[model samples]
Target: MALPLSVLLVSLLLLIAVPDIYATFHHGVHHAVGSRAHHRIVLPKHHRPKFKPGPWKQAHATFYEGGPGSFGGACGYDDVVREGYGLDSTAAVSNVLFNNGQACGACYEIKCINSPQFCKRGQQSLFVTATNQCPPNYYQSSDNGGWCNEPREHFDLAEPAFLKIAEYRGGIVPVQYRRVPCKKQGGIRFTITGNPYFNQVAVWNVGGAGDVVSLQVKGNKKLKWTPMKRSWGQKWETNAMLVGESLTFRVRASDGRYSTSWHIAPKNWQFGQTFEGKNFK
Candidate 1:
């Protein structure tokens, strides 16, 4: 049966209107769901700030005679060799500050502030280097409580350095110290030690922003560079003897500075020999 024209037109209009109405409803629902999802997201909180290294710090200092025949210390360098190399009045710092030889070769300036009488007539401060570790368990026999066993920031100074700032009678003194850049006049010095079977190289006379951090060695015949391990103190060592006729060293300081010493050690280099290499500063 054929429907009337008016009824057919009305039916068509209703169909179009129904689709428009459904689209409007869907649009509204989509916006509502999107708004709710946006609200559910959370923002993270800010993190804590990092610590800044200070110029000056307070610490306890004690004087001790390294004594005769006292050579290498916990950092592993011979004290006699260190002194001969012009590192006068070296100090042994606590494990807290030593950082397990990471702080080796670092320099510090100390001033005695607690006792005025112990201070020298005109001397107000003394500068020392970190060459050894003051073990916490090790106690000084002379003093009942050792400086090493003291607080974290304790400094065990050699007798000479201690006397410069304080009198010998004052076994312990409160001091204010600061980390300072080492002032070296000449280029870096390389001290070679160990037996013929092994090669141990100690970097000394380093003058720059920070102490030595990494070392690499290359021989004349070797195509690739070999990284050296930090044996102790400022010393870097390799168990096997260098193969090539000439040896070169690449040194990297803690401050991220690098220096290469080309052929510093000769083929016939003997043990206990010292060589001066290019400067880092």
Candidate 2:
């Protein structure tokens, strides 16, 4: 009962004409397995876009008293105006934007939107430096006293900054904000603290991408660079015995830019004294 030769040849031709089930088609063209269509493009996690560029994001803003002695907040930026931030142009951001104090010295342009009644008539926007953290009050709901809670972006702006964009009575106004380059006057400033064996430095008055990511300290011209760990907020500390030596610092900003300040501190520099160094563009 074997098939005839002609029938067997026709069946073999039909099998060869059949298409593959897994084949990818484009423009009615069938591509077989192992073609370029089967390949995928993958990007590294660090290379992925973290935020959209040039887009204003939604957030809430309220005013806070920006007194002389009470200007500093969680980021330890004491006396913001004295640290080169202009008068009343400072804010305490919510946890998300604060990014565990990495957002310290980061400048932002904020404006009241969708509320014409409260928004200023001709003022464009207001620039403010992130000087503190608006901690979330978990006792209240997100819309109430917990405005700074997780998943919510809030800005506790200085009273003057808020007034520039909205009326004082607005209280909490809906706003749009975007990160902007910090326009600092002079160079980066470092305030040295801590004991002789441990040095805690508070960095401020930074320009460009103001938030510092990595920092290294060289005790003097003869010593190698030693990396400093972030103690808290913008304060970086090192346990090296760098007492009585002129100090130089290499600072790396969040934008991956680096700046080196050579021998900015004198050997006789006091613990309470602040030293100015080179800054980023």
Candidate 3:
């Protein structure tokens, strides 16, 4: 019984010593010193190499897909866009984002490349529902908005690429527009796009968000749209006065992403005096 107990004790001791022995032999900590092992899987920094011309199509390339107002975060044409937003390993942001491990790369997925488009006239916004007809020979991703979501794993710069094309048409393109009904709360009842890709639209030259007494529109084949107006790429410039004094007029453009203030200015005007009717005694 004593011999068996001795064997059991020695086996337990060897098991405990194996890890230290390995560390001592390989880690240069000196076997007699019995120090901890160096244990970490060192990974090389992540990087994107510059591409050659042939495979470079998607390199700085972007494309569009999907119908009007049907963006489902799946990278499509009707998606929101901004220029100079992508991972360019040759650029500073990419270099910094990688070396420092910033979450900027994680916060917002590159929806789609803002590519270019060819509209004969500048793009226009509309009211009372206007359809954005894609140019001929151009087709959006017919199949999207499902589990095959927009590719966000990479630098998707398609929407901006599309906008660049439209910009080449001069000014900006109006994807969709809605009336912002002026309410007592001072916010206009503006239209929002059904597409998640596009996030905003705009309207200008109107009274208080609440002061908008009414709105109407007449459409033309030439433009996006305007309220009580009949043309695309054009707007109704009207004046609004508070109490017949202190006036202001503003202009705006909307494309479904958000409304933008084109311009604004105050006019010199005055309110008339109020009169109180009374009978003399």
Per-model TM-score on C-alpha atoms: 0.70, 0.78, 0.17
Q: What lDDT tens digits, residue by residue, belong to model 3 across residues 252-281?
A: 212111122221111222122111111001
Could you tell which candidate, 2 or 3, scores higher by TM-score?
2
On the 0 to 100 scale, the lDDT of residue 153 in model 3 is 17
Quote the lDDT for 103 in model 3: 13
Of candidates 3 and 1, the better by lDDT: 1
The C-alpha lDDT values of all candidates are: 0.73, 0.82, 0.24
* Per-residue alpha-carbon lDDT of candidate 2 for residues 1-281, written as tens digits (9 for 90 to 100): 99999999999887776554324244245444335455533433244222222568999998788574465667787777777775578888999998998988888888889888888888788888888889889999989878899999999988988888899988998999988888788899999998888789999998887788888999765557999998767999998877778999998888777788999998888888899999766
At residue 261, candidate 2 shows an lDDT of 96
Q: Is candidate 1 or candidate 3 better by TM-score?
A: 1
Q: Which is the leading candidate under TM-score?
A: 2
> Which candidate has the highest lDDT of all?
2
Model 1 per-residue lDDT tens digits across residues 1-281 = 99999999999999999999999999999989988887665432322222223399988788666552252366656654444433345788888888868787777889888577766667757888777787886646424565565455888887878888888888888889988777766778888888866778988777664478898877777535888888877788887667445778888776666778999888887788888887665
Measured by C-alpha RMSD in angstroms, how accurate is candidate 1?
11.8
Q: Residue 133, candidate 3: how far off, in angstroms?
A: 7.0
